[model samples]
Target: MNLLSDSRCGSEEEVRCLLVLPDINILSHSGVSHTVFWLLGIPGLEDQHMWISIPFFISYVIALLGNSLIIFVILTKQSLHGPMYLFLCMLAGADIVLSTSTVPQMLAVFWVHVAEISLDRCITQLFFNYSTFISESGILLVMAFDRYIAICYPLRYSSILTNSLIGKIGVAIFLRSYGTIIPIILLLKRLTFCKSNILTNATCKYIVLAPVSCDDIRINIWYGFFVLMSTVVLDIVLILHAVFRIPSQDVRHKALNTCGSHVYVIILFYGPGIFTTHTQRFEHHIAPHIHILLSNVCVPIPISEAIKTQALLS
Candidate 1:
């Protein structure tokens, strides 16, 4: 714990505070400080600008354009109107929201000399990000179920997954995503942040953010793990089931082709999440940047392209 005081107040007794930098010894289950910031020294990270800024900028632009085009095409073209396309539209909308919430702020963090964010804005970012992420996951799950119905019970697929039913699922996804995160945010709201406020990553990530406040992050961690496992992991299982249950060989092959890209997207979407799971216990400067970049920008373009190609072929 490093202690520093305000000396410019022109007082004999200065107001003192403790500054604890994040620990570098990233053991499998090491505990972090109540308020930790960087694994490496901040000054050390500040010097490595190119690794932080350039790739992130390029990736962000790519994601924005790809998602935007998908949304536009889905809206304008009547020929693409179907359950699958509806889900794709929802997916594109979620991707756009997800990218917009984090990318610009991240770019500022890496490129700008005087990048600063208020506490409120950071929380807002986290809220939007988590909401979008959850929604995307839910949409993917619904899509898997859609494919299952379409292949397994082709005669009843239309009746089973009607427009009203799909709309309900969409609402359910939004509710589930946003609702689960409310409790975590409420828990964090009780904690107090009295130390360093510089966010190393471009986005407001809850895993890394929770450690900054002076409170026990056990609840936040447990809740996050539960939600992620249930939503993401379980959804993947459902997707796998859908993939394997196709009756016809041709349908099976086509199903694989259709879902393969989404599976890749799902992996890319959740890859950074592994790092986030450890964020409460360890604070690596490069870790957050890498995770944020991957989650926010790197994965969206390829996924969008896959969606477009599949839509055209179908």
Candidate 2:
């Protein structure tokens, strides 16, 4: 028997009444609850799990090694202790966390068919995934600010962005990312999933799971939109502004070269994100497999591109 369907609830009418009713006492007696989410993986590609697993595993390994090496080199080489490299270290760290947040579980789905995830674990994964994305956007904004200082005010760069200030900025980035997510998690905890417990993506993203809730999710949707707009969208605008304000042609060229790498990364990170978010929200005619594939692929692209960017900068 499917755990999602409880027989003690006399009929579909009674179950609907119990689920829809705001009475805690009725819900408690109904015993109809969803403790686990069935991850749908790639909806149309179930037979090719092994084939798909191969490339995903390879990407994860490359992302891990690449980001780890970037962090290691930055920490070990004293010559690279400038503000620019320090922020790069933070970016690499965020990439590692972001890639790890979902890839392992994705691999499990592809290899072992371990698709059922406990609700708590699902929430944890969603939180980490979003927090890392937010933190990376924050790091990119800080890096843009670092470049703006270096090019526009070279004499004051060191004095303005001291090691102490960079450390504080790092802390602030983490706090900003995590602060935005905590409320979402709290809101998620109060949600009741009385519909199908099957999640439509390989990973547990907020928007992916929000529709499954039987309760009103307009607040969740609006708040998530607010977070995305305030964080990544705002950062993109500032980064672009900083990129265009350099005074000297020679200095501007150099600044553009540095900012070019960041721009590439930003595009890679946000392009798919915007596409996925809009597609999920508006393009209901789109296939579930497309959403699953895009959501999974977008996370690692930044890490791989960051590795390339770091190499070019070095």
Candidate 3:
């Protein structure tokens, strides 16, 4: 930890309590005593930390501003109270939480090298990060269903997706995403972090943090796998079903125009995730720093801009 103590006191020991750095502690599996865990920036590219942060910081700022704009427009404009726009507002909120949960820690690690995080704080970050991520997926799925209803049952769309129903969906996503995470978090309590405390990734994550545990985490791993596959696979199947049921070319065009930018954003959101999984699987062959960098900036960069583009075109 770097010292930022007050020199006017004239005693180094007295000012040692004012460490500006994070409490550098990462938890591991069962065995020894653990407390603060340290996080690392890109390993091989440590010298270029400032350079890496340029784009990461830019993306973080953009995601915040864009999503905030989305929420503002949707909330202020009563005309945008329909299901699709309402869901977009939910998604915008989720994305903002998602990006905020990760980017600050990453920038702290990159620019100031402040990577000290206690076990409690680490677990908190992990929960908020993963919960918001999964919630975003659920929101996207709901949006897909919104489009499906709009295109397939045009006459019944409003009746089916009433304001009350939208409220229920938002609540359900809140419950489901956090519900899935709470159990995993409780399960983590059973394990002792006996392994290395140094995390290779830029931020705290279940996948990265779980491996450092000395206990068997098969249940945690399997549950995570199930949630991920279930969400993505179900989305694909539902979207395909929606597309095949369109009545005519005009309906198809309407569908495309309605959610085409959304499709792009989904791809942008999940593409890095899929690739990050592969990179971790093939870590021996690939540079690990690349994976860390990818993880840090997983906030889809051009997503809000794409929505604006679609709006302008319309």
- Candidate 3 residue-pair clash tally: 12
Candidate 3 structure quality by residue, lDDT tens digits, 1-314 = 34212232122332233233344332334468566677755655666778978888888888888889888988999888888888878877887888887888888987887877888888998889878877877777788678768777889998999999999999999898888888878877777777867677778877778878888888887777777776655565666567656779788777766655455566677667667765564454666766765665566364545554444343
Q: Can you rank all candidates by TM-score, best first?
A: 2, 3, 1
TM-score for each predicted model, relative to the true structure: 0.76, 0.85, 0.83
TM-score top scorer: 2
Each model's lDDT comes to 0.64, 0.76, 0.71
Q: Sort every candidate by lDDT, greatest first.
A: 2, 3, 1
For candidate 1, list the clashing residue pairs, or say none.
none
Clashing pairs in 2: none
Q: Could you say which candidate leads in lDDT?
A: 2
List clash counts for every candidate, in order. 0, 0, 12
Which is the winner by TM-score between candidate 1 and candidate 2?
2
